[model samples]
Target: MTLSCFDLGERMLSVAEAQRHLAGLVGEPLAIEACPLAELSGRVLAEAVHSPIDVPQNTNAAMDGIALAWPQPVAALALVGRVLAGGRFDRPLAAGEAVTITTGAPLPKGADTVIMQEQLAFPGAGQVQVSRPETVRRGQHVRRAGEDVARGSLALAAGTRLGAAQLGLLASLGLTGARVHRRPRVAIFSSGDEVTAPGAPLSAAGIYDANRYSLRGLLQALGCRVIDLGILPDDRETIIGALRQAAQDADMVITSGGVSVGQADWIKAALAEVGELGFWRIAMRPGRPLACGWLGEGRTPFFGLPGNPVAVMVTFLQFVQPVLRRLMGQPEWQPRRLTALAAEPLASRVGRVDYLRGTYHSDREGRLWVRPTGRQGSGILTSMVLADCLIEVDADRQGVAEGEPVTLQLLNDFS
Candidate 1:
């Protein structure tokens, strides 16, 4: 008896549910490694980082000034000594006397306030006059020790992805190395006999495989260790074999095409034979036939994206990338969204969330405007290349009128 193909429900999994499912499948924790700060970018912190010492190490001047008691009348202050950064003043400062200190220099003993050099009048003869203000507070202009970070305080929590800013913060705390989660291994492939590789001469009916390349590039941008499984023909046996092999070695397996309802599409049948098909046919345009499941005996998470070039890219960014972040132990996995005005009217069929490729730029008034690239067809890969964002139109909204507000998901912001 032949196994029957199941039509997955239109029941779309909430973004949270998708994340939890992927996390459950990728149950194994990544082994942590002590990586140098230079190599820590885009890696997840496996351990909480604590400040070993105070940020300033001591009370220091925030400006170049005379460190002395405030409210002193305009009088000659004997320049008893000078305090340079990294140099200490051992002698105590007396009343009516000022110590010349540069920015970041430690505050001298018995001196709390810092009067800027500009506030003092130089009368020559190694003396400077100060017109002190009334009711000046002690420790003014002083950056106290640990004001920014205290010793033993939590500097960064675990599961935080280290970026350039995070790296700089760790470096400021004298961290030379950090324990970070290993990159998740992802295997990418595309199916369809008509798809041919680029650089190869195309037959009369052949089409170059864009989904594989686009998905691979997106995975790379997400910092995944991608394994290109190459293209597979739409044969059940071959698809099942390739998926099983990929599931054996990869934390996740991603494929494009063969996910929709068609006689030649074999990914669903192949997944059911190897593991389990969880859901498909999400209410999203250009990607409505999205499918997800697990494969292999271990049940590695898998994503079956639509064949259209734009749909493949959009679905991966919206669904697969977040799942990858969860597998890598990142706490905040959602992409940033921004609001922009529609540059022109956008027409769409209702019932499916449409992700229209658009180019966004700020007008002189500092308002963001998004204009759809010509030919919003899903098959047009060039439109995606020319687009910087995906303008999200709701499934129930037929279209967007000109100058209307729309939420856009950035595609090339980091790049």
Candidate 2:
């Protein structure tokens, strides 16, 4: 069946419906590449990684203490030898014998329990004394072999984004590199004669283009390779030509404006002329006119964002971000969300999800509360700067009263 991306007759899609529709069209992940451990952070794994050997490699001491066989009814033990990290005891312990063991040192053979150093004393040369025999616990202060990660077991699964912890695990496994999906190459552009690039003289009524810069940063944060196509004029031929060129080299294409269903919506018309249009409008605040489809031969994904600066940010965060993740080989990833008590009444209308820019804070008592950033006008770019999160009001909610709980979609992946 053919999917229509620019059909003016289709009803406006809801936020969730739009997301689900885009998810299916994103297709398979990009090609795989081997990234070194140092370059792996924020990259998605392409295949499940298995540990070559057991973590810790053997039963080891977790604390600096004396290790001995426990519950054997021993009155005392003679200290046979000492072992530090990276050192091993030469011989096994006989009955009623102990070894001084440091943290991370492999346990001497036949030793099953560890007593804290403070709980033991040297009463005589080569003799150890347990001051608190009753306090000694069996099998204490020992990390068993494969306790953390078993040998030949899965360590990191495919589609997992590597972070500090994951990198540390790979390092612990003595690996220098692993297979990861290549970062998606996204071609971004803005349309409108009034949209002027920075460092260029601003014409009368011209505004500096902020969407391109912001889009670059957001795309980079998601580990995408951004290809800036610069600002295109309102001419249909030029827009269509740039999109066709982008599809040749880019995995996806995004435009900042000219998507709404109006006579001036040139990009929407261009998209329909050169490619398919999945949906052009969504039932949401700030950014209602969002178009998603493919350019040229359905190889390069396209996103037509709202023209308003704030709407560009809102729609990108709520919609485009997830699409990028899917294209980057991430599996069903989602941004951060939490419920907070509304610090004040929130403006909303029934039958539409309101993505109000909000700042959430914790009170002295550690309770989280949220409130809208003043004046959520789509053109006010500063509101997004001052805000840390998007306060999401459900379509069923008419409005919010003070102290009512509301869901917040955090702007940052928040680590």
- Top of the candidates by lDDT: 2
Evaluate candidate 1 by giving its C-alpha RMSD to the native, one decimal: 3.7
Clashing pairs in model 2?
4-277, 5-277, 5-278, 6-277
Question: What's the residue-level lDDT of 335 in candidate 1?
Answer: 79
For residues 221-330, write the lDDT of model 1, one tens digit per residue: 76789899898997899999999999999988999998888999999889889987865556666677777877878778888988988889888887877777767776
320 Cα displacement, candidate 1 (Å): 0.5
TM-score of 2: 0.95
Clashes of each: 0, 4
Cα lDDT for residue 348, candidate 1? 75
Alpha-carbon deviation at 152 in model 2, angstroms: 1.5
- Looking at model 1, report the run of 10 residues with the lowest lDDT sum: 1-10
Q: What would the TM-scores of all predictions be? A: 0.89, 0.95
**lDDT computed for candidate 1:** 0.81
